[model samples]
Target: MSLTPGLRFSRSAQYVLLSNVAVPYPARLPYANLRRRLNSSSRPRAQRPRGSPRTVLRRASTASETKPAHGPPAVSVPFDPKSPGSLSTPRDPIPPESTLNPPATTRPPPLDLPARGPDVSQFSYLFRLGKAYMQFYKAGVKAIFTNRRLLRSVAPPSGTASAGGALPTRAEVLLRARTRHDVSRLPVFGVLLLVCGEFTPLVVIAFPRLTPMTCRIPKQVEALRRSAAARREASFRRLAHLRAARGEKAAGAADGKLVAGHIARSLGLTSGWWDKAGLDSPFASSVADGAVAFLAQDDALIRSGGGVGGIEDAEVMLACEDRGMDVREKEVGELRKRLEKWVRETESSSEEDSKDKVKRLLLNHELLV
Candidate 1:
C-alpha cells in the first residue's frame, strides 16, 4: 500500500499515524525543561493585574493605612487543634460587663387602690349561684348514696315510726331524719331550678325553707335562723297569752288540747297547722298526739344511746335545728351543751312533768343555752 506523509504501515497491515501533517510535534526537550513543563501544567495559573503595578501598589498602601492598627486585640480563646475552622474564623468581640448584667431598676411603690366591690351584675350573680347549686346538688347526691342503707331502714318523717325491729342508733336516727327532710326538699328545688332556670336564686330567697340543709348558703341559712328565732319568740308570747286567758283552768283537758295544738304549730308539725279551723279540728288533735309520741319515742331512743352527749357533733347540730333552736353562730360544743341540758331535764321529769318539760324546751328552744 502507498504510505501518506507522516504515516507508516505495521507488520499486521494496520496504518499507524505518528503525527498530523498540519500540526507537527516539537523536538524532544531536556530533562530539566520537561520537569518544569509538567509542573506548570499541573499548577493553577495566577490572575494578572488589570491596572498598572504602581496603581495596584498605591491601592494596597491605602488599604493598609485605612485598616485599624490593632485588629480587635486577638481574643486569646482556648484553641482546639482538632477544630481546624476555629483557627480561620475571626473571634466575636467580647461584650462589656454592663451589657452582660444590666443594673436592676427600682420599681415604684404599688398604688394604694381601694378594694374592689363584689360583682353585683345579674349574670355574674347567676353564674356564681349556678356553680354553688351544682356543688350543693353533688353533695346531696353523695349523701343520699352514702346513707341509702340507713334511709331504707328508717321510716320517713310522716311515718314517725321506726321501720326496723331494733332501736336505731342516734346516728341512724339523725341520718334518717336529715335524709327525709333533704329528699323532700330536693324534688321541689329541682323542679324550681328547671322551671325558673337563672331566676332560681330569687325563688330560693323568697322561700328559704324550700332549700335543703346541704343546699342553703351561709347567708340564707343565717337569715332563716334569724327569722325562725323571731317566730319562735312570737310563739312563746302567744302561748303565754293563751295560758293567761285560761287563768287557773290552763291545766284542764280543753286548755291542754289548746296548748297541745299550739305546741304542734310551734314545732311545725303540719303545713297549715296555724289556720284557726285546722288548729281546733280532729286532724290537729291527732297530729298533736303524734308529735308528742314522736318526741317521747325520740327522747327514749336518745337515752338508750347514752343520751345527747353520745351523739355525733353533726347530729347534735341537726337535732338542735329540728327542735326549732337558732343554730346560727353557735359552735358544736355550745350546741352539745344546750342539747345535753334539755335531754337531762326531760329525763329527770315525771310523765306529766316530762310533757310540760318538752313543751317548755320546744317553746324556749334557744333558752337552753
Candidate 2:
C-alpha cells in the first residue's frame, strides 16, 4: 500500500533514526554553523593553565584532529574528519546496500491466521449471513427462543473476550481485521533495512502502523501511538543492564565543563538539560562557556514535587531523561535507568530528606574518566 502521506517516514528512514543515533536524522544542519559550534565548544576556557585538565583535553582533541585516522573502529569518537563516522564532518547517508534483508530461518513469522478449513467457503452468501451473528451464540436457549433471526445466524461464536457484549466481531469489523506483517522480525533499529530487499503479501509490517483507508482516523491514531510506545519500550529493554551498573561517578563536574560536554554529547544530549530535566534550581548553568551540560541551582524549589494534583513525584524519574540519549544504544542504557531512579526518589522527597539522595547521585552516576 502507498504510504498514508505526511509524517509517514520511509520504513528504512525510521529504522535509521531509531537504530542508529550516530547517524543523525535527516535534519538539515548548515555545515559551516555546525563546524563553528563544534570548534568553539572544543576550545579551552581561559584562566586554566596549559596542563590543566581542560587545557589537556584541547590539546588531545587538536592532536586527534590534525592527523586524522583513516578508519576509526565501532563506537570510535576520534576527532579527525576523515573517518567513516567522524564527528567533524557531516555523516554520510547510510548506504542502501546496508539497509536491507536477513537470511531465512530467523525472520519474524508473518502475522497470519490459522488456516481456515478448505471447506469453509468464505465467499458463499450463506457463510456471509452466518458470520454476522458470531456474538449471539452465548445468549443461549432464551435468546434462541426470543428471536428466530438471531437463532438462525450461523457465524462462528465470539471469542471469550467479548462474550455477552456487542459482537466481538464489531471490533473485528471496525478494525477491518485482516492480516499484515512486515520486517522478518518485530521491527527494531535494523528491521527497516531488511524490508528494502524483500517483496511481500499479507502486509507484514510494524512501526508507523499502516492502515487500510477504511479504518477510522481515531482508531488509526491509537494504533500509531501503541506502536510507538512498543518501540520505545523495546529500546529501553536493550539497556536494562546499564540501569543496574554499580558505583557510577558523581556530576563529573570535578573534571571540568569540557568533560561534561564530552560525556553528554557521547551520550547524545543537547543544550538545556535543566529544562529538559524539568528540575527546579537556583544556579544551574551549562558545563562550560558553550553550555552542553548545565549545573543545577544550590537552592531552588523543585516544581516537580511541590505541585498539587500532579502524579507521584517519584515518577518524575522517567521525565528526567524522558528523551533519548545520543550514545550508541549499548553504552548508557543502564545510566539512563539510574538517572531515572535518582530523579524519582529526589522528587518524591522533602529537600532536607533528599540531601543524601543528591549525594548518592554524584557518587554513583559515574562518568567515563
Top-TM-score candidate index: 1
- Tens-place lDDT digits, model 1, residues 163-269: 34344444344445556676777788778877876466567888888876655655576677776666556656666777788675344455667666666666556
Worst 10 residues of 2 by lDDT: 98-107
Give per-model CA RMSD.
Answer: 36.8, 30.4
Off by over 4 Å in 1: 1-129, 153-165, 249-254, 271-282, 348-356, 363-369
Q: What is the TM-score of each candidate against the true structure?
A: 0.54, 0.19
| Over 4 Å off, model 2 | 1-254, 270-320, 323-341, 344-363, 366-369
Range of the 10 consecutive residues with the lowest summed lDDT in candidate 1: 100-109
Q: What global local distance difference test value does model 2 have?
A: 0.30
How many steric clashes does model 1 contain? 0
In the predicted model 1, the residue pairs found to clash are none
| Overall lDDT per candidate, in order of appearance | 0.54, 0.30
lDDT of 2 by residue, 93-204 (tens): 4221111111111111122123456687765644443332221111211121222221112112334333334232211211111111221122331243245322211122
